[model samples]
Target: MTLARLAELHGVATAYEPSEGVTVQVPDATVVAVLGALDVDATTPEAVAAALGAARRATEDRLLPPTLVRWRDDGPVRPPEDLPPGTRLRVTTEEGEVVEGLDWQPLPLGVHRVEALAPDGRAGGSTLIVAPARVPRPERRVFGLLAQLYSVLSSRSWGMGDLGDLRELASWAGRTHGAGFVQVNPLHAAVPGAPTDPSPYRPSSRRFPDPVHLRIEDIPEYGFLAPEYRDARDAVLADAAELRERVLRKGALIDRDAVWDVKRRALELLQTVELGPGRRAEYRDFLAERGRALEDHATYCALAERHGHHWRSWPEELRDPRSATAVVRADDELTARVDFHCRLAWLTDRQLAAAAEAAREAGMAVGIVHDLAVGVHPDGSDAWARQDAFAAGMSVGAPPDAFNARGQDWGLPPWRPDALAASGYAPYRGLLRELLRHAGALRIDHVMGLFRLWWVPEGREPTEGTYVRYDSEAMLAVLALEAHRASALVIGEDLGTVEPGVRERLARRGVLGTSVLWFERDWSGTGRPLAPEEWRTDCVATATTHDLPSTAARLSGDHVALRHRLGLLTGDLGRERALDAAEVGDWLTYLERLGLLPEGPGDEEAEVRAVHRFLLRTPAAMVGVWLPDAVGDRRPQNLPGTWDQYPNWRLPVAGPEGQPMSLEELAASPRLHRLLSVFGSLAEHRAEPGTGAGAGSAAGSRTAPPDARPV
Candidate 1:
């Protein structure tokens, strides 16, 4: 009982409801393990009593919570009324201004420091977050393209899609298809070395992007390569062409390692090029702006090059980024490598900004919606640098649910809620600021994590994990403040078994929710498809996501066969097939009933169009067209349960017959054009003014000036 109380005191769950009428207590061992991760020991009865008493005494003696949030729109800061009498307060604004009275009138929109001095001479300080009422929203109703950028390779790219491809895709989609935005998977830097983890969700560091996505030709120095470099450059160009052909023509899987090998060699050559005076200045400015965060990441890459990507295996002193800084500067070789990595970061940043600029110039109402992965790989750059910010010996995962009866361990380290709050959420604020810099909107993957996360001990199954809650008010406040500064929309991937009220809370903060057509059913009632009018206005309505089967696969019942082929089906194949078929049939039937689809039996292609047409009919603020769905791709980019069983995150966008298609081919694809025609041709489906509805015909809506900012 003491252990349970201690766990509860630290926001660790003792029990949870997997379903409405069911409850299961977390294993006592799991509770103790989880508490241990939070630096509380409850191994034995004596320890539990001591820990619980210590926790109680600390709480009773504390002057304030670790963090407090003040929305400026709510008026002024309201100090905790429960503070002991004669507890004096002090406020220090982010701009370095001090306020003695604590009135905080005309509150600043930044993270501030609040100090409290008790009558008994006890003093404490807490992070005070001052933020906007909410993030920005698109003023106009619009529809956009959703794609996995790597899967959509252009002819000019080395092999996989690059920032150059992103720029071109955004420009063409905005100008030709009236796309208001193009959302893609995370471009965060990957764990370095060959045979890298393919999933974008498990990034090495969310701070920097992988340089493998750079377009060598876009670098100004590429055109000015000296004659001596021509031979090496030509070799890389030939290899790139071969790599691209291997995927697009030869039907080979997207070899990320091979692509990086080719890109890295070419980048090494590009690094040696002499920067002109103006260009040198630009580079210097970027370095100055990025400061220590950029330096720390570069240092990791430099060390990784010599010691390998896994930081733990390195020399003991090098494990901590702070200490490693001294070790790096002492060695000339490491310093040079760090500088090389820094250059790559600068180039990647430049190209990303270029992509955003392209979208803006193409009249996109919302340029690019960048995806933010939920957490970082446990052994990656972030974990090494921001060591104190994360929970040690614990991973972020899911409890047992319908998706996976065994639950899911993502192998990503979660931030320590205590550390984040103690640091004034500066780390969280910095991350959001970096992501939103060039984004028209930011998509937070697993957005529910802002509230709470399931923490599984290092050696435990995901099922053994218990939930640990965070200061959600502080989390959302930091997000709101950053998004407001960027004038960017916030979209939370509030999918899966969301805890009750999570979606509502996200919506209240002007954060858009993701609503897939297949899942928008009345689960509690008829289990029937939700009507268009019944869909919520605050969502990015779409037919599919990267994790789910493509529209063609779902309609043709091919996903079930694929799952069975891969040995991923836990149940009888026949029953699974029947259930899947019935589910698709229900959605198709609903589409017909809603008059979104033509009567009678439709072909697979027509069915795909009908599904998206249903999305447009909803009063959703934004509608997303899965890029592959526009074509006839039938494979999922990621198959959740099986890692090696399926070529997850390695397949290019292919045709109905599974032939990898190039960006040029997709642009000219008759099937894709036919599907998009629905978006541009629907007359009666036009959203009424002031409805916040979208999917306006692209035919006449392309009149916005090139300079028009994203709505």
Candidate 2:
């Protein structure tokens, strides 16, 4: 392929200009492969001449430049042995000495600063940093939520669990259940509109929280509304009450958009009043600290509301985030709305911090463990605000695997690896610091992306996606440095088609891997579930995940039937049903063999408790109870790739009869007490073993099966 075609395929903008006379490094193998794939006969004399001419023209035109490409662990430290005549070698070590030598001794580990001065003294150099071998850290604790955050019900929640409900749940878990940490869904900011997207994984912005999570009554300014606005507020309250009643009494799925609509109307009124002096100052400081990024985000939201969510559909000027005309237009027309959105972000941040404080007050050891989604919406504030940092024409996705033969496009642009490195990974580090500010631990979705991601070119199927490598060493180094600074634990979602040695690398960095009970099998052998002793100690073990079915659903084969009914099953019904049955039967038989399952036809709740007890036996450091499992809510929160056809992320925590249970009622229920009692017994057993295991260890072991060994 021509250099122009190769650059286009890689999503490089046409306007890019290489530095003058720079010799860019192109992998010879890659170039030859590209040429062969394009059917260019490079071996022929005429073809060879044409190819050479094209290469020279491309290089001279600066369409392609010889850039140094370095891969982590490519080779041992060595100076360039084959420099051109009069080549000036300048080596700078960690000691900050610039020495001239063609052959220098290996620099000590850690970031060894190096600079190479070109022969002309018109220097072009880059840092040559050494990295320590990535090593796994000791596993930390992880406690699971029963359901999606907004889907959890409390008597006071407007038909769904809000931050208030989470605070209460965390308090109860820490004080009564002895949980070290509480893990919940992504809770990332969602696009604002009717019938809002329920899947938290596909969020508008991973950097911000969705205001929909805020409990209307919990706002400090809620009660201070004008009398004229009081009636509207009361109406909204009544609507919330009705919504809650629908879930609690009628067994209706929670409507996130409806809930948000009620809250948004009320919030608009609440915004009429300015923040109190202290809060206002804090808000100002936040804006000042965030600077132009905050302004751009706010402006994007404002423009989106006016011109539809997609920035591409906006007026020509507004389409470009950096356009001076767009800035002036937004300032003149949407200033108030932009400020309002900014205030919402500030309020959400305050509440998040408050929730952490509440956890600390409630005696929680790790406090809140927040989730980071894999990517942001392509048309959302984050994409518009940080357009320069992301790949414009490529989408992030997964390659075709056994499970998803067609692969999948996430429709979220990924950070350009080169751009991120050039920026010193500032955006990534900033996002992490914000999330970790109030988090005891952070769960990174699709942690494998730190190494490489499937980049699907525009207008191409997922099968055409290619792997774009990243600097995992630099990424993990930044992660470790930040985690150390924040004193927070890290859990990487390392399930599904992980590249070889990735988990081992993450483990070495003190980052925990995710192990779901169903998928944690010895794939190299008979594919049987991993024995507790065989389970990795540096990991979080769970029965299921948001993408999968609940324990009860999986065991009963309801998930299979649901998929079949929805026409999502690719295989014959009999085969799918049989596979599901056999998997569950194997687990049940294993549990019985381990003496964890009670004899006879056990109730679903009893079965779930048995599963937890089984998990408590595993050597894995962290165990997560899919929050829904706690209450026997046997539905998956999300089914991959389905939109509008299924009730994704709408189900509330319900009893067997499908009646939603409020947090107050759930907390007070005998069933809840029984569940907590089982957890308490497990905790007591671990403590008595003199393993120095506390809530953290027990929680970490929640991922293990019964009879599983201790980490």
Candidate 3:
């Protein structure tokens, strides 16, 4: 009882329901570990009781929560309960400007500090967040192309796709097909290691773009290099060319480390070329803007180069990012490396800006829609720099359900609720601001995390974890404020098992939800395909995602076979195939009835076209077409639940025949152009089903082969 009370005060769950009526009590041990992560002492009953008492006392004494929200459009700003009348209020705005008033008043949309003083001289202060009532929404309905940037390689790319490819792809798509935006995977920085984790969802730093994604030749210094560095730079370029050939032609996987190695060498050479006056000024401004955060990140990188990626494994004195000893230990060599990394971050930022600019120049309404991963890698720069914010020795994951009986652990560190509130969600706000730096819309991966997250204790199975509630109001307020400030839209990836009322809250805030075509069924009732009109209007509708199979594979029932080959299927292969085929068949039949699938069921390309047509019929504000689906790509960029056994994130976007393609080839492909033509008349909000050129012209891949076992 005492323990439960303590847990409740800390926003830790004592129990949870995986489904409607099945409640599972969390283990006492797991609760203790989580409490410890939040810096709460819950090891014994006596400690818990004391903690509970302290919490009650704190609650009774506090004038406000660690943070407060003042929605600008709300009627009257209410004061915290029991605040004596005649209390004076003073607000320190985000810009450090102070505003005093007899009582709280309507303030600008920004984070501010609030102070209170009563007649008795008692003083109280709390962080006050003044934000808009809702986030920005798209001005006009739009259709966009979705691609994993790394997989969308071009002839000029060095093994994997880079920002240059993003620029060219966005320009062509927006100008040629009237694409409003181009969505890509997270370009967050990877933790340096012998073999870096390829999963972008678990990156070292979400605040900075990965330097590996930089197009080497695009660096201004590369073109202006001194003669002495030319030989070395050319050698790296040659190596990069060879590496590119190996992947695009020789059927090798995309080697991220190898690509980074070459890029690093090239960067080293570019660093030697002195900057011109204007360029130097830009660099200086970047340094000043990034300030301490950039310095800490660079210091981590430099230290990691010598002591390895894990900060804990480094010398004891250097474990803390701001340790005095660590500062003293920094030598000329280390300082030089730190500056080098800082330069790389600036260059990546510049290129990201350029890509966004190109999209705008091509008339895209919403340019580059960036992805925001749920959490950061435990051993990365983010964890090292802001150790105070993250819950140590705990991982964020999902509870067990139909998908995986044993549950799953994502291995990413979650932000501690206590710390987040204490810091007024500064870390969260800053992360959003940096990501929105060059984004038109930010897609939050697993956005339910704003409300609560399942926290699995270290060395425990994911099944034993319990949910930890976050102040969703504060979370959403911070998110809305950031998005509003940037004049960007917010799209929440609200897929998988979601709690009731979650979607409603997100909608109320004007945050768009993600609606995948296959999963938007009326499961609680008829379990039939949800009608186009019945679909949610506030969402980014799509046929598939990177974690899921490509539309080609989904329609052709090839994804099941691929999963079977990798032993990812829990049920009989035959059973799985039937289930997949039936789902595909249901949708195909539904499309035909709606006049969306004029070519009927059997033709694969026609079926894929039908899916998009069905999507367009829905009232969703945005529709995204998987770039791989444009051409007849049968391979998934990523396959969850399998790591090394399957080359999850390494495969290049391939054709239906499983051959690699350059972005140039994809752009020129008639199939791609034909599919995009469906939206040629989208501005009119009515694209005739079979009016797109080349519909039913060819049957490249059948949704279900004739030779397949009968469904």
CA lDDT of each prediction against the hidden true structure: 0.84, 0.68, 0.84
lDDT of 1 by residue, 1-711 (tens): 777778878889999987778898999999988888778889999999999889889988889888888886677777777888888988888899888754667557888888999999988898888888778877766778899999999899878998999999988877777677889999999998878999999999998888988998999989888889999999999999999999889988888889999988988888778999999999999999999999999999999999998898999999988899999999999999999999999999999999988887777777888999999998789998999899888998888776577787889888988889888887898899999888989999888889999899999999999899998999999998888888889888877666777777777778888888777777767767777777888888888899888889989889999989998888999999899888988888877887777844468888888888888888888889999998889899988777788898899999988989999999999998888777784322332322221111110000000110000
Per-residue lDDT tens digits for candidate 2, residues 278-393, read: 87888899999877766777777777777777777777878777782356554765877888888887878777777776666655556677889888888887887777778777
| Residue 126, candidate 2: alpha-carbon lDDT | 42
Task: Please give the lDDT score for candidate 1.
Answer: 0.84
RMSD of each: 5.6, 8.1, 5.8
- TM-score, per-candidate, Cα-based: 0.95, 0.81, 0.95
- Of the candidates numbered 2 and 3, which has the greater TM-score value? 3
Lowest summed lDDT window (length 10), candidate 2 = 702-711
